[model samples]
Target: MQRKIRFNKAPLLGDDLIYVEQAIKSGLTFGDGTLTREVESILQDQFDDAAGILLTSSCTHALEIIAILLDLNKDDEIIVPSFTFCSTASAFMMQGAKIIFADSEIPTMNIDPQSIENLITPNTKAIVVVHYGGLGCKMEKIMNIAKENNLIVIEDNAHGFFGSMNQKQLGSFGDFSTLSFHGTKNISCGEGGALIVNNDRFLDRARVVREKGTNRFNFKSGKIKKYEWIDLGSSYLMSEISAGILKKQLLNSNKIQMGRKIIWMRYLNALSEWAEENDITLPSKPHNYTHAYHAFHMIFPSFETTKSFLKYMEDLGIEAISHYVPLHNAPIVLQTEKRTKELNLCPNSSIYSDRLVRLPLYYGLELSSVDYVIEKVLSFVVEKQKSKF
Candidate 1:
């Protein structure tokens, strides 16, 4: 029987278990323990002097933490690409902010900055941009637009840790940003994340929010006599166990990144000819940007071809998958946004959502596995179809 390849496997490269056991034996398995603080310190240094780095339970929680800081009102709106994870919108929505969906641009599949400009309204409080696949978005343009309108910029950098644009770190450009240590990310702590407080004003509140609405951060740091509930927040803390594993991953990132780069380039080199012949789009990063190599994805000729490719790979014991269905078209949103005009607001997003397919890319994937995946991908052909989305 052919060995089955997984869609993703959490990277376990260095002292993951060693640190986990250390956390356990030391009895400091709670949040903000030594290992957790160490990871945050390392991230702060790496993220180009970010004002604060607070590790959270997950990236979703990281977004939620930012949401807490925003203090949104019902009419206050945030613009995000329709091509991103639901958390990108849902986090703000949970705080009663209206999400104004924007279309995605081709090639990079990052949010179209122009669409964001068009979507902005007087009620727009901020613009949240996701660096899809760790490829930096057009931050220079986006930041200028934000500055012109005085709108806040938040980087949903869940896929963009270690990535940079124009030699500057990606997450650092936004007023605030986030990092994911989820199993699927380029880095893994199994289940963890961090909030990068680029704007120092939010640093104090971020701590309170991550600590369940309390100023316990100051109390713990020996700066306050007593801690109390001072703001609206939640428990978004990552336990020391997860933080320990994350520290090891962070330490080994250079080696892990180099390995993933090799795999990504191999796929690109081997499949470029095939992709060109079939008009399928392969993953790429711009010259001035450094991709974090979270996952390698391709745009199939059609949704039918995407489905067919996934099925073909599965039959060969290779697990392949499609990505986010546009949140604008998700059933929950469709109930109120059922009108055809509203549904078509982000046409590029809808099209790209249907055609994108992701292949497994992780530090632990063996060289043989990478070659096997490339061989399987190259052998698959895009079937011509009259029907289109």
Candidate 2:
């Protein structure tokens, strides 16, 4: 039997268990413990934001915290990419804001800044951009648009940790950004995340919100005699055990990043010729940007070919899969009042929605496994071409 290849496996590149044991031995496995503070401190320094970092239960929770911090109103419109995870829009939607979806551009599936400009209105409050596949978006143009309109920029850097644009960090460009340490991401704590508060004004309230809408953080520091529910919030704090694992992962980040880069390059080099022959589109890395190598994706010739490719990989025991369905045409949003007007505005996004697929690219993935996957892909494409002839 062939060895089973997983779509993704959490990176265990360091003494993760040892740190977890250390947190257990300290007998303080709750939120805001020593290990939690240590992890937060490392991230704060990495993003180079003196404002602060708040470790959260997941990237979703970090996004939620951002929505609350912005104090968005029902009519407030947030321009976001339609080719992203639902949480990106749902977070702001939960705060009663309208989601004005933008289409994705190819060569880098990041949101098109031009589409964002077209969608902005007096009611637009923020521009939420996802750095798709860890590649940096065109922040220079996006930032200028945001500045001219006074719209807030939020980087959904779930695919980007330590990735940079024009030598400046990706998450640092936006007024605020969020990172994911989910099992599939570059850094893993099984399930964890962080909120990067770039602007100082939101820092104090961010702490209070993560602590559940109370002044408890200040009270704990003895700044106030007693804590009170001073604002609307939710419980988003990450447990110390997760933070313990995360701290160790952070220390080994360079090693993990290097290993992933090796795997990504191998796939690119092996499949480039085959991809061109078959008219398949591979992920593009811009000259001035650096990526985290989160996942390897390609655009198949058609939806039928993408499905066939997925099934072929699965038969060979390789776990490859399709990416997100275009959010605008999704059932939940299709029934909304904005359905007719919003659907299919992003032609490229709609085309790729059915064609994009991700191959396994994780920290511990072996070179042999990548080669095997490449071989299987080439074989499948060759067979399809022969059938056509």
Candidate 3:
């Protein structure tokens, strides 16, 4: 039988055509077009920040910009969780700062704030937190730690767009928050990102930095007669085509979020009882935090069981799979660190990376497909149990 489900599918609303038609009509297809400006305004309202919003080619670029704005250098240390995408650490590494890997709270699968306190030293410059699976981390504890040390707080909110904590949005909490609009994310423009600058000190410079160190933004707004390179910067601006697609996605954000939430809940309800009986761990839902449900991941008893279960599901035509290999264990990271000794430090990260697998949860997934995936998973677990008896 053909695979009954796909990992993700982008919603193809007429927004792309509208953006294309607008681009052609205006004869402005490059960056700083009308669409880009409109999207910036929309994001400002969406993020609850009236100060600065600069669009970038991707979240990686946004993080890079944050590193530059902070002027991070050698001797500076940035605390990061080992169980996250490489970009979280790489953005700081590019600035010649030392990366101190922290452990995760296995319950929520987010960075442990208590572990962050243990990792900070005199050289520490920032605490980079990733909102794993669109769920908020323990921000109150994190913010308290940063406040005590006067460290910069940068949120790698790549997986969290509409997610919130204490009724406040994730992107608005940190000094600088970066969001991704990659194809896999809830919101997509094929490839794009935005940086929400909460502090005014970085506003003027961020705009120039994103525009390749030019005051071109000021020039376009008639704030300057002629724009020139006034600071060290790179090309991080998104094109009009990308901005147009993203703006369309933004308009449909509510509908998309609601649909994904339903799928996420279905998975939770279907597997909750069996998961508990088998001693399997399910994703935790905190009281004050609202997850955007970007992914539905579960932890199996052992690495071997996870592998066997994945094979069983595949045989039943479901495309369920595993997620990130911890950055600390990756060859590139090891080469950069030039030390294998540090590899054994993150034991919790190692375990989660080994046994966790993600289920397919996306907008527009059929209800029947949801039931089908859960049925297959249940059958696989039951058969596995029988073999031992």
TM-score of each: 0.95, 0.96, 0.97
Scored against the true structure, residue 169 in model 2 reaches a CA lDDT of 87
Best by lDDT: 2
List, residue by residue over 208-279, the lDDT tens digit for candidate 2. 899999988888789999899999888999999999899989989999999999988888888889899888
| RMSD (CA, Å), each prediction | 2.8, 1.5, 1.4
- What is the per-residue lDDT of model 3 for residues 1-389, given as tens digits with 9 covering 90 to 100? 47668878876655456776777678888887888889989898878763688888999999999988988789999998999988898888998888888888886678998889998898999999999999999889999999999999988999988889998888888899999998988988888899989888899999888888889988999988999999878999999888878888888888889999999999999999999987788888888988978989989989998999888877777788888787777787788778784657678888888889889888889889999898888777789778899
List ranges where model 3 is wrong by over 4 Å: 341-343
Count backbone overlaps in model 1. Answer: 0
Order of quality (lDDT): 2, 1, 3
In candidate 3, where is summed lDDT lowest over 10 consecutive residues?
Answer: 11-20
> Where in model 1 is the C-alpha error above 4 Å?
336-342, 382-389
lDDT of 2 at 264: 88
Model 1 TM-score (2 dp): 0.95
